[model samples]
Target: EDKVVQSPLSLVVHEGDTVTLNCSYEVTNFRSLLWYKQEKKAPTFLFMLTSSGIEKKSGRLSSILDKKELSSILNITATQTGDSAIYLCASNSGTYKYIFGTGTRLKVLA
Candidate 1:
């Protein structure tokens, strides 16, 4: 079965804390790895790592993919209250469907 799992289902950090989120997966045919931030309604794309582009970085967020290890990681530096949101990790199978992990709920205290 294809699946994605995230560690530390929830986290609480004060302002200026650097946090790391982990995501591991097992899939039949992995096409890509995606990271999303879920604050409301729907998740917004944060990063997308594929064979052509295995690393993606944006501002305070960065992510990398390891095809051999079948895992990925998301790092957030200098977290603020505005960064408090659910971080989701998903694996895109070749079939165009994504298998998503439950997500890590980050709570940044002011």
Candidate 2:
């Protein structure tokens, strides 16, 4: 069976704290890894990685994919209350089916 797993299902931190969220997967012929942040509106796309050893970043958020380990990491540095949201990790294989993790709920306090 194919699946994606995310660690530290929930987190609470101060405004300036750094947080690392993990996602591991086991799928045949993995194609890509995607990250999203869900807030009051809808889930916003954060990144998509098709290759390993490369980091995709935007502002205070960054993510890396490790093909060998079949895992990915999402890092948020100097977080703010506005950064609080439910992070989602998803993976797809050769087929067009995506398997997603339950998500990591992050709460940044002021």
Candidate 3:
């Protein structure tokens, strides 16, 4: 069975703090690892990493895939109060279906 797990289900951090979120998966034929950030409306696409070790970055957010370990991590640096959101991780198997994690809720206080 294909499945994904995200760590630290919830977190509280002060503004300017750096946070690392983890996601691990087990799939039949792994294709890619995906990251998303969800606020009030819809989830926004963060990154899709097919190659391991190479980090993807946008603004204060970055993510990396570890194919050998079947895992990935999302890092947020200099977090701001507006950075508070639910972060989601998904593993896409070659079968074209994605196994999503329950997500990690992050709260950033000023």
Each model's lDDT: 0.90, 0.95, 0.94
lDDT order of candidates, top first:
2, 3, 1
Model 1 over residues 69-110: C-alpha lDDT tens digits?
Answer: 888889999998999999999999877689999999999999
RMSD (Å) per prediction: 1.5, 0.9, 0.9
Model 3 Cα shift for residue 21 (angstroms) = 0.2
User: Which candidate number would show the highest lDDT if scored against the true structure?
Assistant: 2
Across 9-29, the per-residue lDDT of candidate 3 in tens digits comes to: 999999999999999999888
Clashes (backbone N, CA, C under 3 Å), per candidate, total 0, 0, 0
How big is the positional error of residue 89 in model 3, measured in Å on the Cα after superposition? 0.1
Please provide, for model 2 over 12-96, each residue's C-alpha lDDT reduced to its tens digit, 9 standing for 90 to 100. 9999999999999998878999999999888999999989989999999999999999999999999999999999999988677
